[model samples]
Target: MDTVMKERDLAGKQREAESINFADLSPTSGFFFTSPFRSLSTEGCLTNVSEPAVDGDVINGKFQQAMQAAFSDARAAGIKHPVLCGAIPFDKRQPSALFVPKKTHWIERSAVMAAVQAQESELPAVLSKTELPEQQQFMQMVTDAVKAMNDGKLEKAVLSRLLEIKTRGAVERPALLNRIIDQNPNGYHFHVPLEQGALIGASPELLLRKNGNQFYSNPLAGSARRESCPQQDAEVSRVLLDSGKDLYEHQIVTEGMRQVLADRSRHLHIPATPELLSTPTLWHLSTPIDGDVLDPQENALSLACLLHPTPALCGSPTRIARDLIEQLEPFDRGLFGGIVGWCDDRGNGEWVVTIRCGTVNGDHVRLFAGAGIVPDSSPESEWRETGVKLNTMLRAFGLN
Candidate 1:
């Protein structure tokens, strides 16, 4: 291991524990976001969910113009400060589900628990699970990807699969949200209603955050499932820190992020090595990055859009990896690997790389998870990684 990794390995071996008491936790509808800086809930859309008029760049094109226009309209309609909040789709061409809410409450997590009135609904028993691509097929897909990488098709690609689940009853969003917050309180927890269902999850990767001229992001990659035994968990974390393949995968993401943000940022601070970040279910190599935006006019949404499809979510050499995903995966990603959070007119907001999340539509819930397939990636390991990553949401529903 390198000197930086060695020092981090010694210091970050212990996992931090966070406990939450649900005295104030409650069920909420509409949109919700809980980060370290602020926790907010907004309801009742004042304007329609605005989408791009033309399909081009995800952030640019008429799409951004339309979003900006929506803010203007909301302002003219007499709202002092309007925030456009929703989920951006995985494919840049796909339409976004952003709108201006009529009411917004910036409250604490405890207050949300206190506001709870509805009883926790019993989550449905699992009827069956139909993987979009079966396990064996997924492994084969991984094999093919490795071959392609060896043949020089691309450096890496993030291949995702959907666990199309059927339950005895419809999945309840509010109850599930409460469970998620209760279990994994430190991550970025979010909810935004969709045309069909709601996008809900607690994500560890912060694509970008804008507070005045300063911006921040925490990107996580190279992860492993936590062991029940403390010693076993520490051993696994150390292995992840030392694994050359994992470190290379992490470098692809952080370095690529630095390159993308270099021009947008006046100054960016990135550590030479990543430290381990623990969620309730897994251990991830995380790099906390921050900087100042070159332009004060840049909205958090636009900056996130600019950095979307990073190697962490997509792959190195983004276009090629994206194309590979299109050809390989059986399902369209939609908003699975996209971003979730809110951006306001003041250019201050937070957006998270939508992972460890799922979509709930009545009796069905399609959960999403992916692994970065590099040259040294193993099909079995990658498959196991996805299962471990899915635990964040699956555990919330009281499933193993």
Candidate 2:
């Protein structure tokens, strides 16, 4: 009895350990996401995307009902633990790409990084480069928006431009992911599947995060390009912290979020001042917000939908700013400035603001970046800010 029972017990334990072995994944298919805490790699689909979710009240949200149903479907299919991963579009009217994967492998973020080899990855040669709005047109758009602000049209409008790069050969997703990881290790790295191309980027802004009844968000605004010299970089960081125009822009985002959380939170805390947060390419004014949920039913997706298009991404007086943005900006935003992250069946997840990201499809990639504009904002300066922001992704391709 002792020998046989012990052998069986040892074998069962080994098999359980083998089931969770880290997956060696290819970036071309499925979904992948890594935050400071953990990493998730998924394979086949357990629950594919359904029809677009209907927009409802703040708590029910644009994707909440549909997300809940998807979880139920996975549970019925005998999946003990189900987690949904994908991107939510900037506009709820557009179709989103959220699904529950059939097989999932979870690993620690540190372990994933430790597995990385230091060898340089190869990228394709550039065939051509194009900007959607061109430089002059984008500057003009900014000038007009500033003029409108002077006319009291709205408090602010965050404007974005798109840059498309064509390569002689297909850009390798694995190589690009490696580059981003090697370059920006402390970011919220994601590669979410879209209807057309995959949305891949390392965003520094935390849109929303929920664990049970507690939530956290850190929005970034008022950025300055980082200088190569340490002294200049430090000075730039100091100036960014003191710049009144930048401070006003930062407050617009923080105060707007404070109002949203005030209505939905049982308790809340927001500092009177913003702190400086740095990335590989830029330094930004960041405000971290914390609160406990008033409604236990509101999960990550629900809360994300409610707080998205925050003043940092869109503008204050959201409806009015969106109207102006629609009238001024030429292209459809698609998933830019939207939220991307994962939520398990338990409703705990992290969503990052989709900044410093690009859409990759075959041999071509489209990168998007934006700058927050207020009345005192200069057109040329704003244009330069956007270019510096694009450097975050450009460096991943070894271009910056």
Measured with C-alpha atoms, the lDDT of residue 387 in candidate 2 is: 91
TM-score of each: 0.90, 0.92
> How accurate locally is residue 92 in candidate 2, as Cα lDDT from 0 to 100?
56
| Superposed Cα deviation of residue 192, candidate 2 (Å) | 1.0
lDDT of model 1 at position 313: 93
Per residue, candidate 2 scores C-alpha lDDT tens digits across 254-284 of: 9898887788889888889989899988999
Ten residues in sequence with the least summed lDDT for candidate 2: 14-23
lDDT of 1 by residue, 1-400 (tens): 3533532442233112322333433325688887666567776888865574234224455766787788899999887778888888877777777889887666555445444433454577889987778899899889988888987768889988888789988877877787787678678888888888888899988888787787888888888889999999999999989989989999999999998889877888999999998888888898988889887777788788888878999998899899888989998898899988888888888889999999898888999999999999899999999888888878877777
Candidate 2 whole-model C-alpha lDDT, 0 to 1: 0.80
TM-score of 2: 0.92
Candidate 2, residue 341: the lDDT equals 85
Show the colliding residue pairs in model 2: none
